[model samples]
Target chain A: MSIKDCLGIQDEELVKKSLENIDYFACIYERYEKKLIRYILRISSFSYHEAEEVLQEAFVRVWRNLNEFDESLKFSSWVYRIVHNTTITEWRKTQSKGKDRKQDIDDELYKNLPSNLNIEKELGRKIDADGIKRVLDLMPEKYRSVLILKFLEEKDYNEISDILKKPTGTVGTLINRAKKSFNQIADKENITFTV
Target chain B: MENSQKLLDKIQKENIEQRKKSEFAAKNIFFWTMFTLSVLIGGLATSVLIFAFGQTEFDLLSHITHSRVELFLGMLPIVWIFFSFVFLAASIALLRKTKKGYKYSPVLVLMGNLIMSLILGTVIYFSGGAVKIESIFAKNVPGYQSVEEKKTAIWSAPEDGFLSGTIISVENEVILQDWNGKDWKIDTKDALIRGRVSMRIGEEVKIIGEMSSEGLFKASEIRPWKGQGNGANHVNN
Candidate 1:
């Protein structure tokens, strides 16, 4: 069996093994590589090359600071936080250089995300991924990130709070505001959904 | 795929250059030591304010009930509180740079700083750290003394109030260095002296009087300074 299947273990256990033998870290990288790329693509104004750079930088930081990885937090949330910070920093650097790059949602990645979203159920309509993407592109970065994390990634409010480094209450408030913003932007863009 | 290989190579190389166990521990120790020192200093500042609040002869709780806005807001120790707050802010700012700090929200971090300062302040206050700090400021720091003097002059007004200080001279007339650091001549002819407290030179006394002139005060009542940090009573024999 490969290292990935060597042990059908928890991420935390994988992290523990990785700390001792650096080669074991490849398991973690393999697990989150695609999801993180898609996350960076959705939230950050980085080209594919820049997003790849951010992903590499983020994994590097994760590997270097694995010992500091808090056992209390989920390994996925910790990795997401590292990636989120790296992407934002890279985005800001490019922003200062007056280079604005916007990335579209990858079709394959979008298809792979969780489909049984409560947002569709709540809206009482079938909202296609293209329409959601259009609304997200029109919304501000803060609102967009919250909505994507809640709807697409299907993360709970507390997990989103941990990933975004915000208070749980603030995360709830942001999710509410993000939904309102999404609906308002969709209405303005003349996008229709059967209610 | 190729990029992951490249990053793996870099990670392995960087891991080799990572500091040793002792060095890492030393860095963390240095950070924690600095954090602790700043917190203690902040606590000391808070202790000084707590001590000052405790030194009041008047019933502060009564004032809160009867003239709360006037007493609580007007007489709040803004200077000492400001210093304590600044120190606390410094402590929290320092803590935010620590390894586990980013885990807390800013409000939670601030609340933690405040609570730690209050607990530390209470500890210092009960352990007499506040008294030592007051004396240290009074003797060593001239600037601190001047600010304290101004505060005393305003709060402990001679009109409808009293002055507490050590007796500087006791010839035919009484001369004392008032709490405001100014010398005053006390006309003590008809003053009622209470307690078995003596009239020795350098003995602390609380004199209730009105400022008669610029540099003179008339005594109505005289009593021994009978609280913490005050000299013990020596009955006149």
Candidate 2:
């Protein structure tokens, strides 16, 4: 038999096997470390505090419920869904607090990022933190989520679909609409996104 | 002119740094893995236990039985998906560092041990794991039984050949280990690599080598687990 046939079913046995194999979790942890952090950072607006808090909460949920994973669904999709949910919850709380969720001037997550955020690369003009936040706040939550997952987190449409639990095509269409919505906000703010 | 050049360089550096911060970190990866592990294990454990323990009339496999909770906890590489959260919650609780913490600490520790036992049960289950380690090891070993006992591997590979099922293990970033019922040692030199598990802390692998192959394949993929060495880019812990 081919190597494929050699393994048992991806059914209950597989699930059981995974739990007994604690290192399996480590294998999984390696897969999405960067993308998730990036997503969390973007949603949390580079707020190390909020991102750290959300990270713990999110992982706690994931670790505690690892077995709940449905094999048929793509793992990344399920993962993104977790991060998205965790991040959204975090983001919402931050929004509710109505405080600037900025990282400390010298947090390690900044990787030696300068005291001044370089928003100037925009269309040869500086896009200050205030400007970006203004536009981001004005954007609908749905639109903002899409944009962040797409651009900031670098997730594809299908992944975004899974994360958002929407249809693949719907995610694609919404991303387009989201971009448009972002532009509208930028226009209203009199801030060119490129700027 | 020099001062202007310095200013521009600093701005550029600041921008790059800003972008990096907005990018990602290790903690992010830790949590993602933790969550996936929990959800996958929890959901799968529940599913399998429901099936394995619920009503398996496999006849010969009767000894391979336990309560649903036991069965669920008994397969694969064991870890308590449910209890980690409880501990984390307790960690938060303990953060208060009050008499309340003293009161709740024992309960948290008990839960931790409970999870440990539950995970260990799965470990024992895989040793044939369905019934008990002595029984399972007495007869045969399943490639993937939840880890219940510390000494047992959640899965087993005889390092030679197998009877059925494919095993998967990630070798060097370029080679993918393939297991097909046959027990075999994965020689990284001859393997077809897939994605990398780690580039820094050497490699973290479970050596039931055969079944862990993640499904057997003729090594053909180029640069299998070869990561962009992204972890190196991050500030390593």
Candidate 3:
């Protein structure tokens, strides 16, 4: 039988199972760590830190509430939805303040990445990865998430759609748009696109 | 090359520091709780003996109220906690005022505590009539025991796994509504409900759902519809 038959299990029962059989669930996290963290980072302003914390929280939540999961919806999709909800909640905290304050933090985080990047001039003149990261950091959360899933995590269009709970077609469009946005920044920075 | 390498090295160092910082979380706060508990039990026993045998004055009213509350509703964890603290403080204060040649000694104090507690216990034990509060939302319904939930599903497993019950109609993602039965919502999440849905008919598939607080079953996990008593283990789905 598929997993959906196990839906309505008790939290205590799941916790007991998790405690007894750590490998069953631990394997899930170990396999998906990079993709999950990148997905969370794309959703949050504090990508690295928030992503780590939220990923850990999401795993703990899954571990603690395993018995609560329904098998009808794919487990990966359900877990991604929870991460999406967590990101939205975190975004709301920053968004709750006045618009000006929100925009201010946004601009600070989304500024021209290469301008801030200190690629030394005298000794070496090389295209820096950090500089590229800074520019990628500027794209809006939705677009950035798609880009990371496409390039970094190497998730396909349908998988990205499932992760973000967006329509598959929209995921495809956003990925194209995200590439365009990244290109614009790269062109403006005078960084030669190798490919 | 030197500056670029230094910058990368610095970022790497910073990332390592951040990861290490995350690792050193706040220590578990429950470790030292038992030490405090031992002191409390000892102090209570000492004070009871002192009050019963004649070392101090015993407030009979306080004893009665405490006994009543405890008997009526088992003392809450927090309430018992504050109580332990109060007793500990009072015992410390009483012992501090050690007096010589006093008529009320530990012997008399001990006797008073025992007699007062004994009397309060007797009064409370006889009053079995529970104080019932009329809930506006819960109009005279039966207790939690009256809540019953039934789920039916037929599922097939191409692979080997334990099978539960079959789901009829799922009301909510978490709450299960029978095809024609009473429905309730389950609060908890993460369950399995399995059945094939071709948009034609509902299958009698296997289900494993939890009974919820609102007297409804939630269906999260489900397998393809199939019969039970096969090879795999099964719970009522």
Give the candidate number with the greatest TM-score. Answer: 1
Give the per-residue lDDT of model 3 (tens digit) for B5-96.
33224434553221221222211122223323434453443333222223111221132323445322322223323444555444433432
The CAPRI category of model 2 is: incorrect
Q: A2-90, model 3: which lDDT tens digit per residue?
A: 12333564434443454445533444555456667666654565546656667765665554455445444456666776776676676
How good is chain A of candidate 3, measured by TM-score?
A: 0.57
Which stretch of 10 consecutive residues in model 1 chain B shows the poorest summed lDDT? B228-237
Model 2 chain A scores worst on lDDT over the 10 consecutive residues at: A113-122
Candidates arranged by TM-score, highest first: 1, 2, 3
TM-score, candidate 3, is 0.31
* CA-lDDT, candidates in order: 0.72, 0.45, 0.43
Candidate whose lDDT is highest: 1
lDDT of 2 by residue, B135-201 (tens): 3443465553332232122123232221112234334432322232343334433432334433232
DockQ of candidate 2 is: 0.01
Lowest summed-lDDT stretch of 10 residues in model 2 chain B?
Answer: B220-229
Tell me which residue pairs clash in candidate 1: none
Candidate DockQ values, in order, are 0.28, 0.01, 0.01
Docking class of 3: incorrect
Task: TM-score each candidate.
Answer: 0.70, 0.35, 0.31
